[model samples]
Target: MKVVIFETDAPLPIARAKHGSYGDMFKALLQRAPSFATAGPVEYIQLHIHADKPDGDVRDFPPLEDVDAIIITGSRSNAYDTHIPWINQLTDYVKHALAEESKTRVVGICFGHQIIGRALDLQVGPNPAGWELSLTEMALTSEGETHLTTAAKEDNKLALMQFHRDIVFPPLPENVTTLAQTDVCAVQGMHRPRKLWSVQGHPEFDTEIERELLEYAAGTGMDRKIIDAAIAKLENQETRVERDRAAVADAMAAFLLE
Candidate 1:
């Protein structure tokens, strides 16, 4: 399978100790979904858009005829922003891929999820209470579990890495179904019958990557007490490697195959 990575945000240099940049996170995701492509066979491209300058032309990338799948990564900005130049184009592209006779399959994470919602006419914005950033347990609904059974062979419970202030509300699109949910968020994962899907949390994140993000958040003037508390809670913490990775890989593969 030929997979194309569409990075909506850029991570700071690792030399700066900013930790898992968008590229790094996606690379880890690909590691879990190894069946999707060979080593270095996955093509990665970037769209650099920030608060200051959020517009760019993506007309030069490979056409849909050459793509088997297109994965969109999370962004630091909201999907409702009017500043991001390529935001509308990205939305249109996703909608088109899922339209009749399109081969490009899409999977969105974090901000990517929000963008998918927006593209499909669902609303996405900040949660009334604010962001939820922690290692949390999410239970797969029957539909979620069924999908997992096709793609996953390990534990049913998933301990996910997450950090998002905004979430989708009022349920998903009419054609979409909720696969999983936590106490905090309802739309953990969604399936549009077939051809497109999305997950709210970061299944691609590992301990080292999460640590880097925490450190970066601290440096960015996020509450020291909050950061310290979160770190302490996550102390000596190591994610379960095999089961979680396999589940994610399986779920994604099954969704794509459908």
Candidate 2:
């Protein structure tokens, strides 16, 4: 399988030291999927469209037919930001990819999720409730139950490691079915049949990565209470591996393959 990794931001020092890069992290996570077992060799092509300033060019990219999937990694920048030069450009590209007929399946995480919403002309901004960080349990909607397969849920809720404040707002496009919800964020996930799938939480993030983000937030002058609480939640979670990571990976892999 040939998957294109669309990187929106670089990883922090600690995360990079362990995971190499955001693309590397996603590749590692996807490899955990059972589908990958029989899928043979996989090729991950990283594209730094935002960082490299691609200037609205697709000629340099591989033909869409060759791409099995495109996973958009989370970013530090807001999806609705007007200052970032490439934010809109990325949105435009994603919009085109989602709208046009192609073999490529698109998946978004965090900023990637919000950018997809922006592309669809839905509202994107901070959650009115507050930031949802660390290991958070999200209740799956009926649609989420059908589309998002996971055995890690208790009371029909799955725990995912998260670190984001902004969200893809409600009343999403009519074509997409909302997957999950939390008190803090209503649209925890959304799926558009075979074309796209996305989650607000970071399925690609491991314990080390989530911990690094929490500590990084602490140093960045984020609210002491928020940082401390997020750190506490991380510490309270089960050992090294998260319980739901594999389930999420398999779900994504199944969607991408479909």
lDDT of 2 by residue, 115-218 (tens): 88998899999888778898888899988877666654446777788888899888987889888998879999889878889999988887778888888888
Query: What's the alpha carbon RMSD for model 2?
Result: 2.6
Note the Cα lDDT for every prediction shown: 0.69, 0.81
How far residue 228's Cα lies from its native spot in candidate 2, in Å, is 1.0
Clashes of each: 2, 0
**Candidate 1 deviation (Cα RMSD):** 3.4
lDDT of predicted model 2: 0.81
Encode model 1's per-residue lDDT on 1-258: one tens digit a residue: 566677777654552254455656665655666565443455555444433346655455567778777777777778877566678777777778777698888888888788888877887788887667756667887778776552233456666677788887756767788877877788887777567778887776665556667789999999988777766655554645335656776677666656
Error of 2 at 118 (Å): 1.0
Task: Name the 10 consecutive residues with the lowest summed lDDT in model 1.
Answer: 44-53
